[model samples]
Each structure stands twice: as structure tokens, then as C-alpha cells.
Target: MAEEALFAGPAIRRLRKREGLTQAAIAARLEISPSYLNLIERNQRPISARVVMRLVEQFDFDPRTLREDEAIGGVEGLVRRFADERFADLGIDREEMQELLSAAPQAAAAFARLYDNAAPASLAADDPFAASRREIERWRNHFADLDVAAEELADEMRLSRGDMGLALVDRLRERHQLSVRILPQEVMPDSLRRLDLHARQVQLSEMLSAASRNFQLALLIAQLEQRDQIDAIAKGARFEDEAARGFFTRHLMGYFAGALIMPYGRFLRACEATGYDLPVLLRRFGVSFEQLAHRLTTLQRVGQRGLPFFMVRVDRAGQFSKTFVGASTARFVNSDVSCPLWHVHRAFERAGELQVQFVSLDVAGEREGGWLTMARTVEGRGEPGETQFVVAIGVEAVLAGELAQARGISLRSDDAQPIGPGCANCHRVRCSQRSLPPRGRKLHFDTIRRGVTPFELASS
Candidate 1:
């Protein structure tokens, strides 16, 4: 019964405490008497709809929790409340029950619904997407600036070119005092790691496949070995999405793996040594092309991070496998939207035919920008499996040097296509192929003329 309050009196009291406001303070803000506000907060007088709205606006509390009492089961709470034997003995009192429900309103209904949610009944359960989303968000914030860490680490470890895998192992043992091993896959059983931080020793079975092996070992070393450093960098980053936070977390584990496998300074020199050729680096390092590509995105630490590139890897169908950005790439402001008319689709037709293209981007509250895009298709999995076109999408401002090195075709400045992985989330203006309007904007149509884009910016 205590938990059943739609806005529970106790929760309101707690909210006041959290904000460090007395009843009088909130009452003044609401232009209500302190005594009246106290009554509503205590569940003595039911909250008015106006107060519910005001709580949402003032405190920025989740509307769903605020309306929990007004939800579907809340009305039934009031019905059951006065459903005494004497009232029921009066026989058919359906109209009376309705009147009682009307008096209780959203509070009763919301309480009932929330009660049903918390109930251990077999059939009904609330979906936990929100919790999962939050976890994912936390992870993203955890590893937002891995590239910076990797770059700064290059000098501290005294690593200069050569085999990154071997050199990183030597440094980890000497500098971090963490033991490194390359156990054969068959040697260890089910367990991946056995850590004793007091002893500062971690033994991981090399039983993991190529990607998994590198990933697990590096993450363990990062967390147990350099937790404070990683956490410090992550704590300072400002994240926009919850899933991005989770992504940052999951990706950081991998970032540590990359740092371990291909230490920054050595890897940067290797990129220059091999001229950023994906296959050459893979054959030399025995890592997957995808892993190498992921490393390219994290090249932004101090003086040594390679070209500050906005590394986006998408296949023929416009599926993004990985996305990374450096400080220089961050400065390449985006047009709150994207265009789909770009020639990336042709890469699917002309598989393996490397193509250079030009695109225009308009940043909101700013002017347009230019970019050079490099796109190509690569075979995926094995021979029988379908060939894939992995396009390395990037901007022109950051590409002058790379363009000069690999000059196949000049990127024309006049062909004003815009960048877009897909239309549903794009924010470009006047795009004929726009399937949806940019998020956070109201789409309005005018009687005089229809815009090329399906949705037009609404005016004040």
C-alpha cells in the first residue's frame, strides 16, 4: 500500500530534500500556500494536474515516474479502497464505484499499473529497455577519449616502431609490473583470466580466437594495469547518449587491446611506413583488417596520433561497422543532417573500384563545409560469402595530405552531395531523398510552395 502511491507522498518529500528546498520554498515557487503544498505532498490532499506538470517542468523529473499514479491500474486502487463488505452488500454499485474512481483520478490508476509492474505474476512484466540503455550509456562515457590515451602513452612507454605486440608486452611487464604471457589456446581451460591485484599478476588463457584473444588480454591489462588513467580520461568526457556511454565502455576494452597490440608511436610510424594500406598492415601485424581500421580512428593523442581523421566504415548497403574521430575531425562541424544521393551505392556495383567523391555539409547555426570521401568494397568472411564494400567516409579539410599521396582522381568541389549513412537520422536541408526530418525540429508545410525535402523547418 505504501509503494502504491502514484506520486507517493514520500517520493515528493524526498525530491524536496534532494533539491534542498523546504515546503515553503516550493510553495512560493508554485504560488501556493505552504500548508496546502504540505497536504498534497503528504498524500493528505491529492495533487492537482497543474502541480504534476509543474514538477515535470521545474525539477526535470522523468514524466513516466511522475505519472505512475495516473497510469492504468491507479483507478482500480480507489475502487478497491472503499469496496468494503457493507458497500458490496448493497449489491450492484457500479455507478458508485465510477464516482469514487472519478474522485481519485490519475493517482489510483497510476498506482495500480505500477503495482502490477512490480507484481511477481507469471504473465506480465515491464520491459527493461531503459535500464539496458542506461548501462550502454555508462559504457560509452567510460572510454570517450581512448585515442588520446593511446597517443600520450606512445612516448611514456618509449615504444618506437617495430613489432607492437612484442614491445608492448615488454613495456607492460617492466613499467606497469603486470605479467604478460601468450598461452597456447589448448593450454588453458574455460577461464579467461585469473587476477591477483595484490600480487599484481594476471594470467589469461590464450584460448581466445584472434580478435577475442587480443581484446580480452588488452582490456584486462587496461583495467587492472591502468584503471586510474583510463577512468580519469573517461570521467572528463561529456556524453550525449546513454548507449554511446555503453559503447565507450565496450569500445575502451577494445581500445586497450589495440593499444596493447599496436602501440601508438610504432603503429603511427607503421601507417606512414606502409602508406595506410590496410592489407599490408594486416599481413605484418597478423590482425584483421577491421581491427586495423578501428585503430585508424583512435589516432589522436598528443603529437603522434596519425592524420586526424573522421573514420567511418560503412558497407555497400550503408551499414556502419565502426566510427571514430580525432580532435581535428571533431572540428569538422556537421550539418545537423545528411544526404543519400551520394555515389557510395555505386561502390556496390563497382566492387573493389576505389572511388573519390566530394560532398557538402551545412552545420546548423553556421555555414557550409567541404569534404573528400574515399569509398571502396572489400570481400567479407570467406570466398563463398558475399563481397562487401567498405567505404572510408571522411571530410576534405582533414584530407589534403592523404589526397596528395594517393591521387587517383581529383575530388570535384562542385558536386555538392552531403554525408549520410541513412535518411531516418539525417539532418540535411532541402534533400529530396530525405525520408524523415531531423530530430528536434518541427516539420511544417507552406501553402505557397512545397520544399524538396519532405519536412520543412517550422517558423516562429
Candidate 2:
């Protein structure tokens, strides 16, 4: 069988334009003729493996960008966007979507942004969190400046040498001239950590676990020390309002806190050395599983990058409480509704125990790729009673060989369960777990025989 061609014309053209290189200059660098390069840029000719390697070697380009560009403002994204009922009447097809992405990717991105802004008032109103998520996604949840600042502070305090919590508390006291006070739950019923600027004290509720206390301390330090940097980064985002900017700023502070507690260089080395053993990492960091999983998502530091892990925290009802997409191109990572078949939902059933699964995400009945996912339940900090959440982390299947958790798991194994973004966007008509039909697909009634699903989609 002939190998499928890789036609990444738009991506190559964008790269060339970004680098201010003409077709002839880029062709010279890639050892290809200007006419051939032009053909490739116009997508008239398929990009060869040799050219791909040359591009990677010459410009330090990520190979995935050539293939997975569709995940971000590409054809697949347009497909999902136009799948909405609002666009059903337009009847846009896949080929048209692909052409739009290929010819005018910037315009396509702007259209996607316009579509988002055109959402119903009920869903869009007072929803700064969505804007915050977009900003984080734009950065791929990695902030080098914040990580460097946090790592410097961590080293200065020698956090890894002794009790991390004690180190943070001492640093706060000595550096900021603030006293640390652990108040009883009755005294501070609602808040977890409160900074009393007037009293020059940082008060923490007794109900908080040791790990929580440490995290809170680190977060405070981030706010005090990294406020200027965080504000500047948040201001760079195209936030709709101050609420969105504030929400993004708070998330950045948390990112800084996570970095402080688990410095990037140290954490990446530990992760690689331990083969990403979660239990071992949890013990070493003195942090909760959720916190560790979240930290794993920020391991994308260019030259010393770790696995491109994606993290998501979902409640029992399947609502995403928090999510960070490091480098994985999996659309389901940011989907509003996740597939029911994913182990993320099943993790609730086996609380505290890690549930691992190899899942294949499908789009429009076509397989996108495989992923190795792990999920476990974590207790949430809610008022009155503690709420439970499932925190899940996943890396692409190709990188699973590097993880200790993926031992004994074969990527080629047929046991890999097929999943989708969710019932709404998924066109897997035969999925037994599908709760609803796909958004744009019409239902076909089969009175004679019932299929795997209750409703069958018509083959248009």
C-alpha cells in the first residue's frame, strides 16, 4: 500500500512567513527547488519525509505541528464548530472546511472566535472562566517566566531539603514580615487561607490538610512575589472583562505555586528517573494526587520537556472543574462533555485507586489517535461537606512507552476502547454508551431491528 501524503501547506507557509523567508530561501535551507517548495506551500505537492526532517533539523520545529495543526484553528476545529445546530442549516461539508483551513487559517481562526462570541447570552453571560481557560490554552498551560521565578524562590528557600510546608512558612515570615497562624475551624469556618494585611498575619483553617496548608502558603508567596509578572501575563490575554483577567491571574498564581512546590527541572528529572510513578512522586513532593497530576501538565519547558500530559478534574456529574492541555492535540481534553466510556468517569467507582485505560478518540467515525489515561478520585474543598472529584491525566499513546504506569500495557492491543468527544459531537452510531445522537446527523429509525445504540443515525 502507498503511504498517505502529508499536505501541510498552510502550516509551512505560515512558518515561512513568520520567519520572513521567501520560497527560494526556505527551499535552499531544505535543499529543495523553489518551484517544488511553492508547490508544497500551495499544497499542490505532498510534503516529503525528507523535507519534514529537514524542517525539524533546521528550524527546531515540532513534527506534530505538521500533522496535528488541525487541533487548533484547523479543519477539525471548524468541523466541531459548524456541527452546532446553529450552523446545521448552512450544511457545510468536510472538504469545504478543509479548504478554508488550508487557504485562510487566520480567517478560519477569526471565524471560530466570532462563533464563540456569538454564543447564547444565557451561556456566555458572567462566564469569565471560559475566557480564562482560552488564555491558558493559548499558552498551552506553560509559563516559563513564572516557572523560572518560582524555581529560583524554591531554591532560595531550600524547600526540597526539609519540610516544604515549614520552609514556606519560614520564608513568608522572614521575607514578608508576616506571622503564620493556624486557626481553629470554628474561628475560620468558611475560608481556607486568609491574609490579614492589617494584622500582618497569614491565617489558615485547622481543617486544611498538611498538603493543602503547604499549597496555600506557596500560593500566597506567588501572589506576594510574582504579582507583577502574573498581572503582566494576564494583561496580555484578550480577556472580555476584568473578571476574566482576574480569573486568569489567579490561575497563573496557582501555576506559580505548583512550580514553586515542584520546580520544573527537579520535577522533570524525578518524573523521568521514576518513570513517572505517581505514588513515588506524591510521596516525594508531599502533595495530593490531583496536585501532582496538575503539575505534570506544566512539564512542557522546550529543550528539557517531559511527556505532553493533559489533566482534567471532573465532578461525578461529568462537569469539568479544571483542565490543562499541555501539548496533547486530543480535542476531548477540552470538550464540554467527555465520553462516558473514558476511565475518568469510572474513577469515581474505584475511589482513591488509579484507573488506567488506553482509549482511541474518534471523530466522525474516523480514528484520531490513541492515548494512555489514568484517573483517580480526589476530595474537593467545598463548603459544609467535602465534595469528591475525579482527576485524570493522559499522554499520547506514542509516548506511553516512557511512563512507568504504562508497563505491561500494549498500544497495539485490541483492548483499547474507542471513545469520542461526547455523545453530542460523536458520530459513533454503534456506541452503546452514547446518551444522545450526534448534533448534525439525522436519526434513522429501524423498526425491524435495533442496533447497539437506541437511535441509529442515517447515512446521508
Top TM-score: which candidate number?
Answer: 2
lDDT of 2 at 82: 83
- Could you give candidate 2's per-residue lDDT for residues 118-161 as a string of tens digits? 75645765689887887887887889999999889888898882
Scored by Cα lDDT, where does model 2 land? 0.80
Relative to the true structure, candidate 1 reaches a TM of: 0.46
Worst 10 residues of 1 by lDDT: 329-338
Q: What count of clashes does model 1 give?
A: 32
- Judging by lDDT against the true structure, name the best candidate: 2
Tens digit of lDDT per residue, candidate 1, span 1-460? 0111233455567678888999999877767789988887766875644564466456634323333322232333334433445446666354755554444544445545455445444322122323332343333222335544655665566544354455556665777787765554456555666665677766666554455445565666567666666556444445444554455555556677677567666677888777666557766666654566666655544334354345555665565554444322222222222245666566667776655666544332222334555566655543323566465545333243343424554444343455542555444456677776654345688989977865886641
Each candidate's number of clashing pairs is 32, 0
Per-model TM against the reference: 0.46, 0.80
Residue 117, candidate 1: alpha-carbon lDDT? 47
lDDT for 291 (candidate 2):
85
Q: Which ten residues in a row have the lowest lDDT in candidate 2?
A: 67-76
